[model samples]
Target: MSKLIWKALLASPAILGAAVVAASPASAQQVSSTTVPSVSALEATGDGSTLSNLDQLNQYGREGRARRANSAEQVTSVSQLSDVQPTDWAFQALQSLVERYGCIAGYPDGTYKGNRAMTRYEFAAGLNACLDRIQELLVTNVADYATKADLEVLKKLQDMFKTELAALRGRVDTLEGRISYLEKTQFSTTTKLTGEAIMMLAGATSANLDDLGDAFSGNNGDDNQVVFQNRVRLNFNTSFSGKDLLITRLQVGNSKGFNGVAGETVLTNQVFGDTGNQFTLDTLQYQFPIGEKGRGYLMANAGVWDDISNTLNPYFEDYDGGRGSLSTFSQRSPIYRLGGGAGIGVKYDFSDNWQLSAGYLAGEAANPRSGDGVGEGGLFDGQFSAMAQLTYTNDAKTFGLGLTYNYSYFGEGEFGFDNAGFVSGFTGTLAANVLPQQDAVTSNSVGLQGYYQFSPKVALTGFVGYTGVDSKGGSFDDADIWYYALGLALPDLGKEGNLGGIFVGAQPYLTNIDGDDVKTDIPLQVEVFYKYAVNDWISITPGVIWQVNPNQDNDNDDVVIGTLRTTFVF
Candidate 1:
């Protein structure tokens, strides 16, 4: 499948996993004093702007003072009580402060000690720092304090600390409260919820015209057939958490056919209770943070999992289209398999715009139960599967590209063989020759898919896949199958409320077998769909499906099956 096709085929949600966790609050940087020119040099230059431009000069002076004030406010070293080398003392003291009170930025690696000697200038500067911080705290708590009173307290604190232990303990107490308040108000509460649904209708017709002529006689017959199927499904999802820190989804749907045929007879005539019926538990998954900075998350799911295909629209079951192509990747050709399973995955961002993921799955293959006569179960015999993918995104263009590979390995399974009949319960030699045979089988598959976005509103998508089978006793040689698809999508078309867009796609497939009787051919598939968003809780999708080849029989013309479908998501 192509990237445009995938985005056009299914509704996608923004991924908010580890990306949120890895983000950190922006920090303020210190303005170094070295960048400021000396006061004597400025005065000596006597720039004319100094006096006539005193106002502008005053603004610069005020900015410089503010920078100095900021530095002074955080300085809390107590050099007077130390007797160690200045550099060593400063490093150790800074480390100790960070460890004890969690105050003052410590050494780059984090360490601190108290055995530091004090210098008059250093002591004066440190004491002034404590006083500055004390004023800042007072302003935060007592916003209405008179200017005179505020200044008086500031001066008193500076005078006392400068002569005492060269630090103001009372001022430290006040600063802690301001830091606590800032932390408390740093984050705001926000929530977001998104939902989608689809409804569809389709019709199909098949015609076979043939003629026969012989030297002596001629005979011929013409067959024309039409089949109609209708299905409706509804899926619902609800999620809540800060920036997707936590997520939950729920899905449900029901489907039924209007007019159809199971085999050679009219499906409506089948006395069965429900000739065409289907239901699904589409998706249920949870995502949560795994490490600091939310570099990634741990995701788990239990429900109908969509195959990792590159195409915009899936090949197996178009929940929105009643009649869609059955994926060869599934157990068989005629049925859409839906089963339960559990799996874990991790998505990590290697850079601002790139990410990768790996996941594993284990459970019953979503095909008919093994032991059935259908040849479908050969590849799904209690198998295990794994997948890896990498993606690159450009936020400015709302575009992304991805590459993926998937593999599955099945355990030993039975293989069946058909033989010309002799009779039941016949003699040993004759019986062995008459009855059909069965044996164990194993199979494997590999696939590659890619996606590209042309713009935020449009995308191109497609993918190719291959599978191989191995059997015991050489009853049959290995067989290979391949599929390719391309599609286009229009997002938020017409900007209608709750309405997504429509998409059309086509896929072609081919298969070959290396055995006593060789066979090869290609099948053509097409689909057209309209998706409508009813609201936050529901979306409707209606679509059509056309298969140009039901069987690879070159002697027979193509057969087409029509279907009508509807899906709702909450």
Candidate 2:
């Protein structure tokens, strides 16, 4: 027999007499009113050492009760027992159960411990007593089945009890099975064992594939290039108790010359051949829940993350469907930059519909310097960034709003600056003169985005962003850029198991450097894409993109570009 069953047997009143010892006189007197049968009556032998089994003891108790009911026996000898104090919670639970299940309650004894802890053995005994009382109630509440005419009702009642017992046993079995499985199961999956990985691949190609033949309008020629970036991710999760889980993720990625402007190229010379891609540890972190509903969570990650515009822009094409544009916009919001770092964040779900999260990142906002001379670090050293986001979701739709701010102090170092007039390995005198000094450049940005669903298959998305850079004593006029976009999404595409959508966007800028020399020119972009689900673990996307004011060259007209891409996910 199992240890639990053996313990249950040893603790039974048949073996351990009902009145083994007594508490204080006052406490004993308080419980003396209840008429409890002597342990001797329930024993199989006179010495009380040779105890009866569970069934035998239960039958003896029932026979005694039956005899009293039939013969109206009175003046039964009552055995007094010491009152054992119970923990506050346990006593409360017991009282609640007694009221709810109509069980026999203890006498009016003011011995509720409220603090006395019970051992596992004692707890098992108390639970078994409660179960026995429940069984008795079940037997009594059911209609009597002692006659031939009541046989059908008796059988039905037996079936009902059997079903209930089966359900209870199934629950117990499930818990035991879970424990056994945990003991034997390995923590790592096959993919992890073989070092196979899953990655989030995203990038934007802003090339002047069709320049419309206008190349010389401004000093900064047509900016055109292709960018490919991917974030490799691996996660491990385990649970000590089934209710609580711990999750850890390792993230790594590479970006090929990532600058804010579309088609802006860096590191013209690819010294590493095709490996000139930007490398970064996007996210390495751990998360765990602290509450029953997982309402509270603790998370920490060290690596680079997407921080950019507040709305979905062609410049940031990551994620597919279900708030894809919204997530993408937030990733590229000017107030944000992806780089190496460590961060700690906490999230709390106020209810089913509301949540809040806050976090801080400590590290550089730009890529770290590499041996290729193209990469540079320490731009935002000794400076950290902070962000807070709020989300509200329901069955039909979800809305999220966030704010991010970053401040960097560069005492005396050569930081990177974008020279608007530099193009094609050429730097003009004006661009060189406008280059921002180390102590002058300080960046700040803010953005807002939202999504609304009109129906199951159709939804609207939009976002707006503003960014400013302060050159303490430089020639730049604290460059400010603003963007706004809206798109329509079709969730399902016929029976092909595909998703496709179209979007229209515009970005208008206001600069103080050129005054009337530079007009408020609006750049427009249009995109259409179709995604094919090749299988459970792979997908492909083919799309086309067109820009009206390419490179913000209003005088040069529009330019268009197209691409075909495929993805594999595990």
Candidate 3:
């Protein structure tokens, strides 16, 4: 085939994959980044036609073909990817593709690590993005390029290069058909809908279920029978400026969680339950640009640090969705969960690999009345936490590092420690099991976390954190808490889009008071799970969770929970 003919065929590869993996576009540079070569700049004339401006894709090799939708600004230069370097073997060879098509395909977390493989589903997503750009160009830019001189050039080529013209037009016809398919299959022009539903069949076995706190505060000798529960979330993501997003999420179902598992709230949904049929607004946030190097977020409700920063655990942290780890403690650093609810945050990238994130959230931002409770502290004085973080990712994107700090204050009677600070209502009783004894409290927490991707198929993530507590108006002088965890992820383990993961960590647990020991045991947690994608909208996961000591009490017996979880995404 002629070079031009070869170029035309490259478009096909971008569409062959059947998966729909969500691609992460470079966010910080969205407002004013470079773009691919334009069709009006190069020539694609037949033998007799005069040379004209053509797209830069012609400069790239066969393997460099790729593109994504412009919903976010596409990276137009290899330098923008940061992870790709000239020293790499494929660097120069892939530059043309990266310069024109957004890193030639990136992971869901926006990393374009070298030589990783792609699943069929993920490739399909690329195809959709390719179709979007191609259709957009054919419908708009091509017509504007049709000058009288250009037509005569084409006429001469059509007559002299009949065979090549025939083949070229044939490819165009195929593309036209694909474009039609795209038009017919689009979700919407202004708004897109995504949703997840998780159903879990679970049961626990423990030597004794007594002395647990919070929901499972008193389980004398009751048998932890098998139970079934579910959680569902629907997200309506709307974008008007292409670079900005308005997110509205709705949640329903019982999240009260398993009966035998006291205070071990792994999932964010573990907070409430037995709602019958009431649907609550789970998240309401707006993400937009701040100048050129910053992205900003305004969260009216249900906001956490994950809303505006990179968590660095793509496989293990699915934003608290059912697709990732089975427990909250394993998903991300407890520091990220410091405070949730109304907040404002921003992420600014100083260079390709370094970013600084800062935010403040108040657990009680709704109620005007003072005192303690959820969403009652107004904006500043209520239960709140302020956060700042500095992070770095390698040029290859295979490694990352972050240093995080959280400063928080909780009111007299508030209880959502694993969430905000020095309170006790969620997670392992030992982790968040403090603060009610005091009239009010303040905390200073520091955390270090990062991840290393060995390849497309395997990755490891680890983190350690510490929170120092000070009594505001209570009997205790000071307290100390600590936690750490490590997780391994194997993607596409048994089949495409399938994942197997294992994690072992200490849930944040109290260790001392006023330089003296507090009666608490190590809150060790071990969790293992595998998710097998049944198709585009469904997946099944089977997992086990073991708690060495519940409620920070060495006297309490260990508890193990085995569960089969099914998830639906759309």
Query: Which is the winner by lDDT between candidate 1 and candidate 3?
Result: 3
Scanning candidate 1 in windows of ten residues, the lowest lDDT window is: 418-427
lDDT string, candidate 2, 22-90, tens digits: 212343443344322232332322333222232333332232121122222222111110122244443
lDDT of 3: 0.64
Off-target runs (Cα >4 Å) in candidate 2 are: 1-3, 6-232, 238-281, 290-340, 350-354, 365-381, 392-395, 398-440, 473-475, 495-497, 507-510, 514-520, 555-559
Task: Give the Å shift of residue 378 in candidate 1.
Answer: 18
For model 1, residues 251-366, the per-residue Cα lDDT tens digits are 23222222211121112111111323544343445555555423333334432223322122322224323222221221111101112244556666677676676665534434
**Tens digits of per-residue lDDT for model 3 on 1-570?**
233433432332222111111121232243113221122211233333322111211221122224322243444454443333456533443453334434245543222332123222122233223334433443465643223222222223223323332334444557779889988998657798899888888877753644544422345446667778888888999998999999999888875554544456445445445566478887899999988999999999888888877888888988878888888778788778777778899999999899999998888787678866544568886888899999999999999999999898777655344555333445655335545443577789999999999999999999999988877785666778788899999999998989999999888777675422344678788899999989867999998888887656666777788889899988
For candidate 1, give the lDDT of residue 229: 33
**What ranges in model 3 sit over 4 Å off?**
1-189, 206-223, 259-262, 268-272, 372-375, 420-424, 514-518
Measured over all alpha carbons after superposition, the RMSD of each candidate to the real structure, in angstroms, is 21.0, 14.7, 17.5
Answer with 1 or 2, whichever has the higher TM-score: 2
| Model 1 stretches with alpha carbons more than 4 Å out | 1-201, 206-284, 292-340, 365-381, 397-399, 412-446, 455-458, 492-510, 515-518, 532-542, 561-570
Question: Which of candidates 2 and 3 is the stronger one according to lDDT?
Answer: 3
